[model samples]
Target: MTDTFKHRGLRQKLVETVKAKGIQSEPVLKALGKIPRHLFMDSGFLDHAYQDKAFPIAADQTISQPYTVAFQTELLEIKKGDKVLEIGTGSGYQTAVLCELGARVYSIERQQELFKKTSKFLPKLGYRAKKLIFGDGYKGLPEEAPFDSIIVTAGAPFVPKALLKQLKIGGRIVIPVGDDVQTMTLIIRKGQKEFEKHDYGEFRFVPLLEDKN
Candidate 1:
Protein backbone atom coordinates (compact mmCIF):
# COMPACT_ATOMS: atom_id res chain seq x y z
CA MET A 1 0.00 0.00 0.00
CA THR A 2 1.20 3.49 -0.86
CA ASP A 3 2.12 5.50 2.21
CA THR A 4 0.09 8.68 2.68
CA PHE A 5 0.23 11.73 4.90
CA LYS A 6 -1.95 10.00 7.49
CA HIS A 7 0.24 6.90 7.57
CA ARG A 8 3.45 8.85 7.84
CA GLY A 9 1.94 11.14 10.45
CA LEU A 10 1.01 8.15 12.59
CA ARG A 11 4.65 7.15 12.79
CA GLN A 12 6.02 10.66 13.06
CA LYS A 13 3.62 12.28 15.53
CA LEU A 14 2.95 9.22 17.68
CA VAL A 15 5.58 9.82 20.35
CA GLU A 16 4.93 13.55 20.56
CA THR A 17 1.17 13.13 20.57
CA VAL A 18 1.08 10.27 23.07
CA LYS A 19 3.83 11.78 25.24
CA ALA A 20 1.79 14.96 25.60
CA LYS A 21 -0.99 12.75 26.94
CA GLY A 22 1.35 10.83 29.34
CA ILE A 23 1.87 7.67 27.29
CA GLN A 24 5.54 6.75 27.86
CA SER A 25 6.44 3.63 26.00
CA GLU A 26 8.77 3.44 23.03
CA PRO A 27 7.51 -0.06 22.18
CA VAL A 28 3.96 1.22 22.00
CA LEU A 29 4.97 4.12 19.79
CA LYS A 30 6.73 1.72 17.48
CA ALA A 31 3.71 -0.58 17.36
CA LEU A 32 1.34 2.29 16.64
CA GLY A 33 3.58 3.29 13.79
CA LYS A 34 3.40 -0.20 12.34
CA ILE A 35 -0.38 -0.61 12.61
CA PRO A 36 -2.36 1.34 10.00
CA ARG A 37 -4.97 3.29 11.94
CA HIS A 38 -6.43 4.69 8.71
CA LEU A 39 -7.72 1.28 7.69
CA PHE A 40 -9.74 0.98 10.89
CA MET A 41 -11.75 4.21 10.61
CA ASP A 42 -14.25 5.28 7.95
CA SER A 43 -12.91 6.85 4.77
CA GLY A 44 -14.51 10.17 5.67
CA PHE A 45 -12.44 10.22 8.88
CA LEU A 46 -9.22 8.91 7.39
CA ASP A 47 -7.66 12.36 7.40
CA HIS A 48 -8.08 12.47 11.18
CA ALA A 49 -6.58 9.04 11.79
CA TYR A 50 -3.29 10.20 13.34
CA GLN A 51 -4.81 13.16 15.21
CA ASP A 52 -5.22 11.26 18.52
CA LYS A 53 -9.02 10.91 18.36
CA ALA A 54 -11.31 7.92 18.29
CA PHE A 55 -13.26 7.34 15.07
CA PRO A 56 -16.41 5.35 14.41
CA ILE A 57 -16.16 1.88 12.96
CA ALA A 58 -18.73 -0.77 12.12
CA ALA A 59 -21.30 -2.03 14.78
CA ASP A 60 -21.56 1.48 16.22
CA GLN A 61 -18.25 1.06 18.03
CA THR A 62 -15.37 3.51 17.78
CA ILE A 63 -11.79 2.58 17.22
CA SER A 64 -9.99 3.94 20.29
CA GLN A 65 -7.71 6.94 20.04
CA PRO A 66 -3.98 6.35 19.55
CA TYR A 67 -3.01 7.42 23.06
CA THR A 68 -5.61 5.17 24.64
CA VAL A 69 -4.41 2.23 22.58
CA ALA A 70 -0.79 3.00 23.41
CA PHE A 71 -1.52 3.56 27.07
CA GLN A 72 -3.32 0.23 27.40
CA THR A 73 -0.67 -1.67 25.49
CA GLU A 74 2.08 -0.07 27.50
CA LEU A 75 0.47 -1.12 30.77
CA LEU A 76 0.58 -4.75 29.68
CA GLU A 77 4.41 -4.72 29.60
CA ILE A 78 4.36 -7.08 26.66
CA LYS A 79 7.25 -9.25 25.44
CA LYS A 80 7.69 -11.24 22.28
CA GLY A 81 5.50 -14.37 21.92
CA ASP A 82 3.25 -13.43 24.82
CA LYS A 83 -0.10 -15.26 24.63
CA VAL A 84 -2.65 -12.47 24.63
CA LEU A 85 -6.42 -12.50 24.95
CA GLU A 86 -8.43 -9.51 23.72
CA ILE A 87 -12.06 -9.34 24.85
CA GLY A 88 -13.54 -7.06 22.20
CA THR A 89 -12.27 -6.95 18.65
CA GLY A 90 -13.91 -3.73 17.51
CA SER A 91 -12.46 -2.98 14.07
CA GLY A 92 -9.46 -5.20 15.01
CA TYR A 93 -7.27 -2.10 15.11
CA GLN A 94 -6.09 -2.74 18.66
CA THR A 95 -5.70 -6.38 17.78
CA ALA A 96 -3.44 -5.45 14.92
CA VAL A 97 -1.26 -3.45 17.25
CA LEU A 98 -0.99 -6.37 19.67
CA CYS A 99 -0.08 -8.80 16.93
CA GLU A 100 2.43 -6.35 15.56
CA LEU A 101 4.08 -6.21 18.99
CA GLY A 102 4.66 -9.97 18.70
CA ALA A 103 1.86 -11.05 21.02
CA ARG A 104 -0.16 -14.11 20.06
CA VAL A 105 -3.55 -12.39 19.97
CA TYR A 106 -6.62 -14.49 20.85
CA SER A 107 -9.46 -12.03 20.38
CA ILE A 108 -13.16 -12.57 21.06
CA GLU A 109 -16.06 -10.43 19.87
CA ARG A 110 -19.72 -10.60 20.82
CA GLN A 111 -21.00 -8.69 17.81
CA GLN A 112 -21.50 -11.33 15.14
CA GLU A 113 -21.33 -8.88 12.30
CA LEU A 114 -18.20 -7.26 13.65
CA PHE A 115 -16.41 -10.52 14.43
CA LYS A 116 -17.35 -12.11 11.12
CA LYS A 117 -16.24 -9.05 9.21
CA THR A 118 -12.96 -8.66 11.15
CA SER A 119 -12.09 -12.35 10.74
CA LYS A 120 -11.65 -11.66 7.05
CA PHE A 121 -10.44 -8.09 7.38
CA LEU A 122 -7.63 -8.85 9.88
CA PRO A 123 -5.89 -11.52 7.78
CA LYS A 124 -6.28 -9.46 4.64
CA LEU A 125 -4.51 -6.61 6.41
CA GLY A 126 -1.75 -9.02 7.60
CA TYR A 127 -2.54 -8.88 11.34
CA ARG A 128 -3.58 -12.42 12.05
CA ALA A 129 -4.38 -13.53 15.65
CA LYS A 130 -4.05 -16.90 17.34
CA LYS A 131 -7.83 -17.23 17.46
CA LEU A 132 -11.10 -15.27 17.12
CA ILE A 133 -14.34 -16.26 18.84
CA PHE A 134 -17.78 -14.86 17.93
CA GLY A 135 -19.40 -15.61 21.30
CA ASP A 136 -19.66 -13.40 24.39
CA GLY A 137 -16.28 -12.16 25.61
CA TYR A 138 -17.64 -11.60 29.12
CA LYS A 139 -17.16 -15.27 29.94
CA GLY A 140 -13.61 -15.16 28.63
CA LEU A 141 -12.18 -18.10 26.72
CA PRO A 142 -12.21 -21.02 29.16
CA GLU A 143 -10.72 -23.51 26.76
CA GLU A 144 -7.82 -21.19 26.17
CA ALA A 145 -7.20 -20.30 29.79
CA PRO A 146 -3.89 -19.01 31.15
CA PHE A 147 -3.17 -16.30 28.63
CA ASP A 148 -0.10 -14.13 29.17
CA SER A 149 -2.16 -10.98 28.69
CA ILE A 150 -5.77 -9.84 28.22
CA ILE A 151 -7.27 -6.62 26.86
CA VAL A 152 -10.93 -5.59 26.82
CA THR A 153 -11.83 -3.14 24.07
CA ALA A 154 -15.26 -2.30 25.55
CA GLY A 155 -16.06 -1.00 29.01
CA ALA A 156 -17.70 -3.19 31.66
CA PRO A 157 -19.46 -2.39 34.92
CA PHE A 158 -16.56 -4.02 36.77
CA VAL A 159 -13.55 -6.13 35.88
CA PRO A 160 -14.88 -9.57 35.06
CA LYS A 161 -13.56 -12.13 37.53
CA ALA A 162 -13.84 -14.95 35.02
CA LEU A 163 -11.26 -13.17 32.95
CA LEU A 164 -8.94 -13.00 35.94
CA LYS A 165 -9.12 -16.75 36.23
CA GLN A 166 -7.92 -17.08 32.68
CA LEU A 167 -4.89 -14.88 33.19
CA LYS A 168 -1.63 -16.69 33.76
CA ILE A 169 0.46 -15.92 36.76
CA GLY A 170 2.60 -12.81 36.24
CA GLY A 171 0.36 -11.66 33.42
CA ARG A 172 -1.61 -8.47 32.81
CA ILE A 173 -5.11 -7.57 31.66
CA VAL A 174 -6.18 -4.12 30.49
CA ILE A 175 -9.85 -3.37 31.05
CA PRO A 176 -12.05 -0.30 31.30
CA VAL A 177 -14.27 -0.45 34.37
CA GLY A 178 -17.28 1.71 35.39
CA ASP A 179 -20.55 3.03 34.02
CA ASP A 180 -21.40 6.04 31.84
CA VAL A 181 -17.71 7.05 32.11
CA GLN A 182 -14.98 4.46 32.72
CA THR A 183 -11.48 4.11 34.12
CA MET A 184 -9.06 2.35 31.84
CA THR A 185 -7.43 -0.15 34.19
CA LEU A 186 -4.65 -2.70 34.22
CA ILE A 187 -4.75 -5.82 36.40
CA ILE A 188 -1.76 -8.04 36.96
CA ARG A 189 -1.93 -11.53 38.37
CA LYS A 190 1.11 -11.75 40.54
CA GLY A 191 0.48 -15.29 41.65
CA GLN A 192 -2.26 -17.71 42.63
CA LYS A 193 -3.62 -15.37 45.29
CA GLU A 194 -1.90 -12.10 44.53
CA PHE A 195 -2.52 -9.44 41.95
CA GLU A 196 -1.74 -5.79 41.21
CA LYS A 197 -3.97 -3.06 39.81
CA HIS A 198 -3.25 0.22 38.06
CA ASP A 199 -5.67 2.79 36.70
CA TYR A 200 -4.81 4.44 33.40
CA GLY A 201 -7.47 7.10 33.91
CA GLU A 202 -10.90 7.86 32.39
CA PHE A 203 -12.21 7.11 28.93
CA ARG A 204 -15.53 7.06 27.07
CA PHE A 205 -16.35 3.71 25.53
CA VAL A 206 -19.36 1.72 24.40
CA PRO A 207 -20.71 -0.74 26.98
CA LEU A 208 -19.54 -4.31 26.84
CA LEU A 209 -22.74 -5.92 25.65
CA GLU A 210 -23.41 -9.56 26.34
CA ASP A 211 -24.05 -11.41 23.08
CA LYS A 212 -25.29 -14.98 22.67
CA ASN A 213 -26.14 -17.04 19.62
Candidate 2:
Protein backbone atom coordinates (compact mmCIF):
# COMPACT_ATOMS: atom_id res chain seq x y z
CA MET A 1 0.00 0.00 0.00
CA THR A 2 3.04 2.22 0.27
CA ASP A 3 4.36 3.77 -2.95
CA THR A 4 7.22 5.95 -1.78
CA PHE A 5 9.41 8.40 -3.69
CA LYS A 6 12.00 5.66 -4.26
CA HIS A 7 9.34 3.45 -5.85
CA ARG A 8 8.25 6.34 -8.08
CA GLY A 9 11.83 6.91 -9.17
CA LEU A 10 12.25 3.25 -9.99
CA ARG A 11 9.03 3.31 -12.01
CA GLN A 12 10.34 6.26 -13.99
CA LYS A 13 13.45 4.28 -14.81
CA LEU A 14 11.23 1.36 -15.85
CA VAL A 15 9.27 3.68 -18.18
CA GLU A 16 12.57 4.76 -19.67
CA THR A 17 13.66 1.15 -20.08
CA VAL A 18 10.45 0.22 -21.82
CA LYS A 19 10.68 3.34 -23.96
CA ALA A 20 14.19 2.34 -25.02
CA LYS A 21 12.73 -0.98 -26.08
CA GLY A 22 10.64 0.97 -28.66
CA ILE A 23 7.38 1.65 -26.83
CA GLN A 24 6.67 5.17 -28.12
CA SER A 25 3.04 5.62 -27.09
CA GLU A 26 2.93 8.58 -24.76
CA PRO A 27 -0.32 7.48 -23.16
CA VAL A 28 0.96 3.99 -22.56
CA LEU A 29 4.16 5.26 -21.02
CA LYS A 30 2.25 7.72 -18.85
CA ALA A 31 -0.11 5.02 -17.59
CA LEU A 32 2.85 2.76 -16.79
CA GLY A 33 4.46 5.58 -14.88
CA LYS A 34 1.32 6.23 -12.87
CA ILE A 35 0.49 2.70 -11.74
CA PRO A 36 2.26 1.33 -8.62
CA ARG A 37 3.41 -1.98 -10.01
CA HIS A 38 5.07 -3.11 -6.78
CA LEU A 39 1.77 -2.90 -4.96
CA PHE A 40 0.37 -5.52 -7.33
CA MET A 41 2.96 -8.11 -6.34
CA ASP A 42 3.61 -10.16 -3.23
CA SER A 43 5.85 -8.32 -0.79
CA GLY A 44 8.70 -10.77 -1.34
CA PHE A 45 9.13 -9.63 -4.92
CA LEU A 46 9.02 -5.93 -4.21
CA ASP A 47 12.67 -5.39 -4.93
CA HIS A 48 12.27 -6.72 -8.47
CA ALA A 49 9.02 -4.93 -9.23
CA TYR A 50 10.51 -2.03 -11.15
CA GLN A 51 12.67 -4.13 -13.42
CA ASP A 52 11.53 -4.47 -17.04
CA LYS A 53 10.69 -8.15 -16.59
CA ALA A 54 7.83 -10.40 -15.58
CA PHE A 55 7.80 -12.06 -12.18
CA PRO A 56 5.82 -14.92 -10.67
CA ILE A 57 2.53 -14.15 -9.00
CA ALA A 58 -0.08 -16.31 -7.31
CA ALA A 59 -1.44 -19.42 -9.09
CA ASP A 60 1.82 -19.72 -11.02
CA GLN A 61 0.90 -16.87 -13.35
CA THR A 62 3.34 -14.12 -14.12
CA ILE A 63 2.58 -10.44 -14.03
CA SER A 64 3.51 -9.52 -17.58
CA GLN A 65 6.74 -7.72 -18.31
CA PRO A 66 6.31 -3.96 -18.42
CA TYR A 67 7.56 -3.77 -21.97
CA THR A 68 5.15 -6.45 -23.13
CA VAL A 69 2.24 -4.71 -21.48
CA ALA A 70 3.23 -1.41 -23.04
CA PHE A 71 3.73 -2.98 -26.47
CA GLN A 72 0.33 -4.69 -26.46
CA THR A 73 -1.50 -1.68 -25.07
CA GLU A 74 0.16 0.66 -27.54
CA LEU A 75 -0.89 -1.61 -30.40
CA LEU A 76 -4.51 -1.38 -29.27
CA GLU A 77 -4.37 2.43 -29.61
CA ILE A 78 -6.98 3.00 -26.94
CA LYS A 79 -8.93 6.27 -26.93
CA LYS A 80 -10.35 7.80 -23.81
CA GLY A 81 -13.68 6.20 -22.78
CA ASP A 82 -13.35 3.43 -25.34
CA LYS A 83 -14.84 0.12 -24.25
CA VAL A 84 -12.06 -2.44 -23.92
CA LEU A 85 -12.18 -6.12 -23.02
CA GLU A 86 -9.16 -7.75 -21.41
CA ILE A 87 -8.55 -11.49 -21.20
CA GLY A 88 -6.49 -13.13 -18.42
CA THR A 89 -6.74 -10.62 -15.60
CA GLY A 90 -3.62 -12.06 -13.86
CA SER A 91 -2.38 -9.60 -11.26
CA GLY A 92 -4.77 -6.84 -12.46
CA TYR A 93 -1.69 -4.84 -13.41
CA GLN A 94 -2.69 -4.58 -17.04
CA THR A 95 -6.26 -3.77 -16.04
CA ALA A 96 -4.95 -0.90 -13.94
CA VAL A 97 -2.92 0.35 -16.87
CA LEU A 98 -6.03 0.22 -19.08
CA CYS A 99 -8.00 2.13 -16.46
CA GLU A 100 -5.21 4.67 -16.20
CA LEU A 101 -5.65 5.22 -19.93
CA GLY A 102 -9.38 5.83 -19.30
CA ALA A 103 -10.76 2.74 -21.09
CA ARG A 104 -13.92 1.14 -19.77
CA VAL A 105 -12.39 -2.26 -19.09
CA TYR A 106 -14.16 -5.61 -18.82
CA SER A 107 -11.66 -8.29 -17.80
CA ILE A 108 -11.99 -12.07 -17.31
CA GLU A 109 -9.88 -14.39 -15.20
CA ARG A 110 -10.06 -18.18 -15.25
CA GLN A 111 -8.09 -18.64 -12.06
CA GLN A 112 -10.52 -18.30 -9.19
CA GLU A 113 -7.78 -17.42 -6.73
CA LEU A 114 -6.61 -14.50 -8.81
CA PHE A 115 -10.14 -13.48 -9.69
CA LYS A 116 -11.18 -13.18 -6.07
CA LYS A 117 -7.97 -11.50 -4.96
CA THR A 118 -7.88 -8.98 -7.81
CA SER A 119 -11.65 -8.34 -7.71
CA LYS A 120 -11.13 -6.93 -4.24
CA PHE A 121 -7.65 -5.51 -4.67
CA LEU A 122 -8.15 -3.34 -7.78
CA PRO A 123 -10.93 -1.20 -6.34
CA LYS A 124 -8.82 -0.61 -3.23
CA LEU A 125 -6.29 1.07 -5.50
CA GLY A 126 -9.03 2.99 -7.37
CA TYR A 127 -8.55 1.09 -10.63
CA ARG A 128 -12.09 -0.04 -11.13
CA ALA A 129 -12.81 -2.12 -14.22
CA LYS A 130 -16.35 -2.11 -15.57
CA LYS A 131 -16.52 -5.86 -14.82
CA LEU A 132 -14.21 -8.56 -13.52
CA ILE A 133 -15.48 -12.09 -14.10
CA PHE A 134 -14.12 -15.40 -12.79
CA GLY A 135 -14.54 -17.32 -16.00
CA ASP A 136 -12.69 -18.71 -18.99
CA GLY A 137 -10.69 -16.20 -20.99
CA TYR A 138 -11.03 -18.38 -24.12
CA LYS A 139 -14.78 -17.77 -24.25
CA GLY A 140 -14.40 -14.00 -24.00
CA LEU A 141 -17.32 -11.94 -22.63
CA PRO A 142 -20.07 -12.22 -25.22
CA GLU A 143 -22.72 -10.73 -22.93
CA GLU A 144 -20.72 -7.49 -23.23
CA ALA A 145 -19.82 -7.73 -26.85
CA PRO A 146 -18.78 -5.11 -29.38
CA PHE A 147 -15.72 -3.95 -27.46
CA ASP A 148 -13.72 -1.16 -29.07
CA SER A 149 -10.65 -3.32 -28.50
CA ILE A 150 -9.65 -6.62 -26.86
CA ILE A 151 -6.32 -7.54 -25.29
CA VAL A 152 -5.33 -11.08 -24.38
CA THR A 153 -2.67 -11.13 -21.70
CA ALA A 154 -1.68 -14.76 -22.13
CA GLY A 155 -0.45 -16.79 -25.06
CA ALA A 156 -3.07 -18.65 -27.09
CA PRO A 157 -2.51 -21.57 -29.43
CA PHE A 158 -4.66 -19.73 -31.92
CA VAL A 159 -6.90 -16.71 -31.95
CA PRO A 160 -10.28 -17.42 -30.37
CA LYS A 161 -13.08 -16.80 -32.84
CA ALA A 162 -15.37 -15.66 -30.03
CA LEU A 163 -12.96 -12.79 -29.32
CA LEU A 164 -12.73 -11.85 -32.96
CA LYS A 165 -16.53 -11.73 -33.18
CA GLN A 166 -16.81 -9.64 -30.05
CA LEU A 167 -15.08 -6.61 -31.48
CA LYS A 168 -16.98 -3.66 -32.95
CA ILE A 169 -16.41 -3.15 -36.65
CA GLY A 170 -13.02 -1.50 -37.15
CA GLY A 171 -12.08 -2.60 -33.65
CA ARG A 172 -8.87 -4.50 -32.99
CA ILE A 173 -7.56 -7.34 -30.80
CA VAL A 174 -3.97 -7.58 -29.61
CA ILE A 175 -3.18 -11.20 -28.82
CA PRO A 176 -0.12 -13.40 -28.57
CA VAL A 177 -0.81 -16.56 -30.61
CA GLY A 178 1.28 -19.74 -30.27
CA ASP A 179 2.34 -22.47 -27.83
CA ASP A 180 5.57 -22.42 -25.77
CA VAL A 181 6.57 -19.23 -27.57
CA GLN A 182 4.09 -16.74 -28.99
CA THR A 183 3.91 -14.37 -31.91
CA MET A 184 2.24 -11.16 -30.97
CA THR A 185 -0.65 -10.84 -33.39
CA LEU A 186 -2.93 -7.92 -34.12
CA ILE A 187 -6.21 -8.47 -35.90
CA ILE A 188 -8.41 -5.57 -36.96
CA ARG A 189 -11.99 -6.11 -37.97
CA LYS A 190 -12.69 -4.58 -41.34
CA GLY A 191 -16.30 -5.63 -41.99
CA GLN A 192 -18.89 -8.21 -40.96
CA LYS A 193 -16.61 -11.02 -42.11
CA GLU A 194 -13.35 -9.35 -42.95
CA PHE A 195 -10.29 -9.02 -40.71
CA GLU A 196 -6.82 -7.67 -41.30
CA LYS A 197 -4.05 -9.55 -39.52
CA HIS A 198 -0.51 -8.56 -38.63
CA ASP A 199 2.11 -10.44 -36.65
CA TYR A 200 4.77 -8.83 -34.56
CA GLY A 201 7.81 -10.68 -33.21
CA GLU A 202 7.81 -13.47 -30.66
CA PHE A 203 7.44 -13.33 -26.91
CA ARG A 204 6.64 -15.77 -24.10
CA PHE A 205 3.63 -15.73 -21.82
CA VAL A 206 1.62 -18.03 -19.62
CA PRO A 207 -0.84 -20.08 -21.62
CA LEU A 208 -4.38 -18.69 -21.86
CA LEU A 209 -6.41 -21.41 -20.18
CA GLU A 210 -9.99 -22.47 -20.88
CA ASP A 211 -12.92 -23.93 -18.87
CA LYS A 212 -10.91 -24.80 -15.76
CA ASN A 213 -12.99 -22.71 -13.43
Candidate that scores best on TM-score: 2
Top lDDT prediction, candidate number? 2
Model 1 TM-score, all chains together: 0.93
- What would the per-residue lDDT of candidate 2 be over residues 1-213, giving only the tens digit for each residue? 999999999999999999999999999999999999999999999999999989999999999999999999999999999999999999999999999999999999999999999999999999999999999888899999999999999999999999999999999999999999999999999999999999999999999998975
TM-score of each: 0.93, 0.99
Question: What is candidate 1's CA lDDT for residue 171?
Answer: 89
Q: Cα lDDT of all candidates, in order?
A: 0.86, 0.96
lDDT of 1 by residue, 1-213 (tens): 356765776667866878877877777887787777777767888678788888888878888888888888988888999999998898998999899889998999988888898999899888889999888888999898889999998889998889999999988899999999999888889989799998877998889988655
Model 1 worst lDDT run, 10 consecutive residues: 1-10
Query: What would the C-alpha RMSD of candidate 1 be, to one decimal place?
Result: 1.6
